[model samples]
Target chain A: MIRHIVLFTWTDDATDEQKATVTAELRKLPDAIPELRSYTVGPDAGINQGNHAYGVVADFDSADDYLVYRDHPLHQAVIAEHIKPILAARAAVQIEV
Target chain B: MIRHIVLFTWTDDATDEQKATVTAELRKLPDAIPELRSYTVGPDAGINQGNHAYGVVADFDSADDYLVYRDHPLHQAVIAEHIKPILAARAAVQIEV
Candidate 1:
């Protein structure tokens, strides 16, 4: 199995309702991309005095599938229209188990 | 709870034996740090078309505990002796859940 983990930090000004929309949009990706076997999205809602904008953990069958998912146009749309503008910085890790 | 996620890429030349030793040492961190709630470490061992060095996901009780883990002497020793010298780049995300 292959896992692609992305950790992102957004601007502090971003609001809760906006993040909820983003989360819903992101969760809908698996249906659009055949290569994306599984998708899990989470938020760090200041419950423990820490705040992370979002975390996306995805599971795929192979790296090629992951690559296809990465290059998909729908993914691009999400990044361009939603993520890129609000995110401060993002870190991604792609590895096989 | 707070989640402290650190993603690191080590130099390509670093050996498996070195990585194993590092993994063992990293796994032992929870024992030394009282606040650490959970620890998970994984490798991107080149199974798929792409390769990643390693991935670490940790769970903590609070941001203060996470901060202490960050500053802990044993953790610092591991970084200085094992991680820092061999790492190309490292990314970390700490947030509440």
Candidate 2:
């Protein structure tokens, strides 16, 4: 299995509504993308309150499937429309398991 | 459930043996710590070749359980004895799911 993990820190001034909109849009991705085998997204519980405020973990059968998910128009649309505006920093790790 | 996600980048000069030792030590945590409901650790497949070289995803019943795992002597020992020397950077997100 290939796992793609992304951690995001929202821009300081981004409203709760914007964050909610981004979260809801991300939550819809698994249903829209056939290559995404599983998806999980949530906000940090803030024990440390580090830079990352939210995270998304998704699984794919192979790296190719992951690439497909990454390049999918719907995924791109979400990034361009919802993510970029409020995203402060993003970090990701992709690995086979 | 609370999920603790950590990403690590090994020091450029760190040896393969050191990285392997760290991975093995982390893989043993679930058995050593009863509070660890699940544990997954592995190196990055390097599709993006981003800063993080390895990732760990571990789950617990609650945030308190996660704290126990974090503060456990075994974990602290591992960080001090095995992780800190070869670690370059670390990023994490903890959230209730």
Candidate that scores best on lDDT: 2
Q: What does candidate 1's lDDT look like per residue over B14-97, in tens digits? A: 887777777888988989998888776777645444334777777777778887888899999988888877888676666555
Q: Worst lDDT window (10 residues) for model 1 chain B?
A: B44-53
For DockQ, the strongest prediction is 2
- The TM-score of predicted model 2 comes to 0.94
Residues A9-64 of candidate 2 have per-residue lDDT tens digits of 88989999998888899888888898999887888888985548888888899999
Question: Interface RMSD for every prediction, one decimal?
Answer: 4.1, 1.4
Q: Which candidate should be chosen as best, given TM-score against the real structure?
A: 2
Worst 10 residues of 2 chain B by lDDT: B49-58
Instruction: Compute the DockQ of candidate 1.
Output: 0.28
Model 2, B18-90: lDDT tens digits are 9989889987788889999988788888898554788888889999999999899989888999889998887
State the lDDT of candidate 1 residue by residue for A9-60, as single tens digits. 7877877776777787887898999888877677754433343457777778
Clashing pairs in 1: A50-B96
